[model samples]
Target: MSKTKNSFNHFAWEYFEGLEKTQKGNTLIRKKGRLELICSYIGNEPISEIGSPRMLEVLLDIQANSLNKAGKPTDKAERCAGIASDVFIYAGARGFCSSNPAALIKSQLAKSSYGHRPAITHPKDFAKLLRAIETIVGDPNTINSLRLLALLFVRNGDLRRMRWADVELATGRWQLKPLKGQGKVNMVKDQVVPLPDQAVAILHKQQKINGHTEYVFFSQTAKKHQIISENTANKRLKDLGYQNIHCAHGFRATAKTLLQEQLKYPLVLVEMALGHTTKDPNGTAYGRFEYIDDRSDMMQKWADYLDALREGRDTTEFRADAQNKADSTAQLKALIDQLGEDKVLELLKNKD
Candidate 1:
């Protein structure tokens, strides 16, 4: 690792290039870069190396303080701690270190009030961005891959590594080798992400690629058996004037917002659809139990939601149990409570 790069960066290149043919490996490389930036405020050692309790505490302090330093209002430090916990657990499993500081860090996380805010892209703007993505990936070969992207709402890298034999068109499910596996995966851990009709359309397109290749989303410049580069989808989005408005990752964020805000699905369902591995501070791990039924239904609904948005339809109705609305109420309550009930009554009286 460069004195410059930190955390998971030490082995990121080896980690990334090793799986050149698989899209997930490529994304890990980019995510490592993000992790490296995050480490700039902490330290440069491999995360596995810093698993001692003392190191963990120091990391917690640094993370909490870094948010303050950024001049943004202090977020619930628990989320940052949660991210740290997942990182340590992941690093430790890889034999990078003996202990997990993130676990220790998580214990301390409970004491800090939830201050993190979920960053999301607005649905209307996201719709504009999707239009751009669809337009950019319109070539016969890339279009199926790109359309399937929004349908599954999986990470760009995972989508790129999709293989031909993985999909069962009649069943509408696409099998994916779990990207987040830390240890040698059991057959049980190999994932099969359910595909919606939107996702199915792409499968049909991919079938026409003409090459008897193993990969589903084959790019011309791909390495042996490899499909797309880690950055291709986002790079294409940039070309279409969308710029920073959307990214390959932004799709997940957009889905979260729309699922809860627009479609009114449960928070648990939204998180599951995104394949979130970490749990909330309240012990809500995303995929510990198979969410097959819940995720399948949610994904189909989500695909429909995106379809409506893309086509500019005005007739979709969200389920009544949506989490985004609940979140709004809670946020409003917080803001109003902070201002005091008396103030609210006064404002209400004035409005009349």
Candidate 2:
């Protein structure tokens, strides 16, 4: 190892390499963008020379200077601080720094509530959006991709990077590779998403068009056989008059809300279906595959529920089904409490 301290830019490159080793598919692209911003602000200075104050200045500069595609001011201080904090921690671990100063002043960074992504949480509004997606005149690939995002509720990056090889139509499962920031550190396992019948049907149609290539949403215009751009789906949504109301990422939030609040699935099941990490009561993170069966069932029901909403069918039946299951569970618990587990099991077996 060189005794000379590494520059911030050098450290960032190494850190990004570390991210690439662990993360998959478009995960580190955002981090690399943030690193570019940091490097632009600080130049190629020695990592040890910049402490917490300088880190704070860099973050504030990013916040005040960043602009969105719409040419409006956007705040990225929180994101910048997060990246710097991680970089400093990596440097500290490698003996190039004494402490992660970015962590110390992270809380003091600028906080803004200006750029919240819009989502349709209401069932009726979501139904209208689904109708719009179905009827929209655009690239067929873009439309189908948008529908898949709404139905499956995976991250936009995950959807864009989907591979046909990862999809098992017969088994109704899509084996998702870990995106840049998903799952625990150093535990990069493929996430198995249980595809609903509707989602699988969409995939079958997509296969007819793009089956020759690896990506499900492959775009001929894009470089290196990559799928469509990240903004393609959202741009379509905006063109459909959902600007600031619903974007591609909004689909995930929309699904998360409706599944729990409307369909009454357990929070854990919903989170698992979305491939998010949730901790148990002891503060330990749940295993990635802890609730596969329940998640599968929940995803199928969610797809069915979306279909009902799209057709403007009465959704009360979904709520009724959920209530019936809850009631059955409660009654079973009561019976077990009264008659004992063995007696209850015997009674159940007799009834069977």
RMSDs, each prediction? 13.2, 7.3
- In candidate 1, which residue ranges exceed 4 Å CA deviation? 1-120, 183-189, 278-291, 318-352
Flag regions of model 2 displaced more than 4 Å: 1-27, 44-48, 66-75, 82-100, 112-115, 183-189, 320-352
196-309 in candidate 1: lDDT tens per residue? 887777677677773478777776677654577776766676687655556666666777777777777777666555665545679754454467877777777777777777
lDDT of each: 0.61, 0.80
Candidate 2 local lDDT, residue 325: 77
Instruction: Supply candidate 2's per-residue lDDT for 120.
Output: 89
The C-alpha TM-scores of every prediction are 0.56, 0.77
Provide backbone clash counts, one per model.
5, 1
The digit string of per-residue lDDT tens for model 2 on 2-113 reads 2235777777777888888876444467778888877787647888888878887777777667766655545577777778888888888899878776787767854454
Q: Per-residue lDDT for 352 in model 2? A: 100
Q: List the residue pairs that clash in candidate 1.
A: 75-115, 76-114, 76-115, 76-116, 264-322
